[model samples]
Target: MSMFGAVDLSSFAPKQGSTPAEPAAGAAHNGRPGGLVVDVDAQNLREIAEGSARVPVVVVMHSSRAQASVDLVDLLERLVVEYAGSFQLARVDVDAAPEVAQALQVTAVPTVVALIAGQPVPMFQGSAPEEQLRALLDQLLEVAARNGVDGRLDLDAAAHMAEPTEPEETEVERQAREAIERGDWTAAEKVYEHAIAQSPADDDLKAARDQIRMLARMDGQDPVALLAAADAPGADLDTQLAGADAALAQGDVNACLGRALEAVRAHTGEERERARLRLLELFTIIGTTAPEVARARRQLATILY
Candidate 1:
């Protein structure tokens, strides 16, 4: 299965290339074999959002009062460990966070959704057997890898600390990454663009290019300044779009998408079409499977019609 559609772990693992770098000392995956699972609530939802930018957060909306939900959670608790640190889990009791349930529109007790890069991905709204759950999770890992999200969380303080290792990159990617490290956005973008032109079907190259493009847009721009300019009284469409770009560059995906949607409603004619196109571009960058993209798509259509 493609998982998040047309994307797989190709971005995460190093494709066999010309040269291989020696493994660094003390490189290891973060967290223990048990994996990192957090008990989340409405008050700490920010934790889930922030963590998703680094890795996928599996949101398990369940009711402790429901035996089925309890059983499902226990099953998941056991399952997450087997994957090591591929993805972390977050469980929210509907009884404790009814507002969270309402916001997610979760109609069932044992709903499971994934938050990837601050966007929701609806998994399912009810219980499934362990076999099915395992299959879905396997697919999720593929999606995570494809999206370049293979981060690890810190283990409990009592446990020994181990730093996560970066995946090896193709030689061309190494060149691009070196450019990025040296703060040469133009060079990095050119590297990926050239490589992509040569290997047109390489999803990894495409992802790398998108990342460099975003970085180029964000280059030398202060987030606070951009946000202030956007919030200035009667800020025009261009200013707002700039602010939205800054937001997306800073991992504020919701704000970035929201600003574009607002622009669509607040403008008319050519400007409105620009806003609509911007939203579509963002959908492409973030992956159309994102729940945020789906919601914004509906909102854009409504506004257009």
Candidate 2:
């Protein structure tokens, strides 16, 4: 059985001519190495899946006509470059690779699945918020770690080609980095907070503050313990909150958000308000623009009013 559930895609095979001719060397977008992102069809699907023994392979089933599909492809491509080859992305056009889609049982245009040691682990369907996707990828890495599939691609060439020169860091940014290095999150937070207060309109400063706050919340905490406590019978709201914080620190955005939302539904009066307010704060940490936040925001409204 696949990690997500039982999935039998072994019988499906890509029809001939459905596969595109292999691209010449350096023909991929931005001259990315072939190992980073590869178009997969029935012919090479098994080979790529088996290669997951070395590194996690993210299979993205997409359609050309859907704007959401296009957006997801772009996001995955960006993440591929950002992750520097922690995993390989297998881009499968559903229309052209129906057998592959059938094998995966994809019911949506943008279904993502992870492969490790050739076993499929379903990830998500449709367009997921960027932050949520990042969290999911982090979890995927953890999964890879457990399975001994730890391999990193050399991204120096790609990074050099994509990154542009930047100005020297400001003194405040320098102080923040220094404080972070010394494990003084409070000092780091204060630096970013002060910078934000001075600028008042700098989104970058606000983002930095948010990141530092999340770091502080999870600092010196054991995530496994927190999660265990949160799941214990008769666990209190504070314990769950701690679990949520630890989850956020570990880049499990869904777990973080879900815990708070559950608290909101379970508590009442001041307790409910506390959960609601905390949820709002998490939304800020995750950025209000994320689709998960948007969905959670709507759900919050329904709970409150």
Candidate 3:
């Protein structure tokens, strides 16, 4: 069952009466950046167990002889690099820090514990996939965020993976952007419609599609004819917004604004917000100095509220 090679480490015991040791030079706390791997000798181990009474300490217990332990250390290193902001990651050699190891009752090469508010909270033990570790970190982060710990969960890092970060763009999105760039509203419409089939979570992609849909809807000569031919009847979602984009490009601000407003009526939640955002972006592109900019800002305020 061991992902790493088998090493029967069921008999290792922490030496008696050995006080926790000091961090041997580079011992980092909770994966904080630049926290170095410290030798978990007696003095460091005790310091970890009792020092730093404010921030929680995550103690990783490992055995050098165990291949699994080696692998766990490697994984911890990766987690630290990516998520050091979450917590400090420290390791203990059950072999060296016997007293402290005995105190924690660590029998395995790799055991993880989260110390929140200076109390030990158990995490994964043994080698685990990086995804699992990341998940655990996220759970802790959510708690940290709710508790307002450590300054708003590091927004920069959270934005990289948080729900608010734009979703993944689909092939539909790529095709749509291409069409728009080439000034081919017809082709743009088709690509955006296809993209909606995949419906990637990125708000920016959905916003782009909505812009195109708005444009397509307003391209005169055969307004109803175009919508009837290309856009679905009940499609007031992103694809419809793509048509609106086409309309805007054609200089039909009235129709573009109308379709965008209807999109607000038809779609709710994040999609509605995205539609509103597109219109605002349109306002900027067309020049905020214009009268329409003020109107668009009002609309954006209504939707956001």
Best by TM-score: 2
Alpha-carbon RMSD of each model:
18.2, 11.9, 22.7
Model 1 agreement with the true structure over 71-152: per-residue lDDT tens digits: 8789888876776666788888765566687677665567788876656677776568888888888877667666655666
Native-referenced Cα lDDT, model 1: 0.69
Once fitted onto the true fold, the runs of candidate 1 whose alpha carbons sit more than 4 angstroms away are 1-166, 199-204, 268-274
Worst 10 residues of 3 by lDDT: 4-13
- Tens digits of per-residue lDDT for model 2, 56-152: 8899988653456779889999998888788888899865676788787665567899886667878877678999888888888887767666766
Flag the better candidate by lDDT, 2 or 3: 2
What is the number of residue pairs that collide in model 2?
0
Indicate the worst ten consecutive residues by lDDT in candidate 1: 18-27
Q: Which parts of model 2 are misplaced by more than 4 Å?
A: 1-14, 18-171, 265-273
Q: Give the range where candidate 2 is weakest over 10 consecutive residues by summed lDDT.
A: 11-20
Model 3, residue 105: C-alpha shift (Å): 2.3
Model 2 C-alpha RMSD vs. true structure (Å) is: 11.9
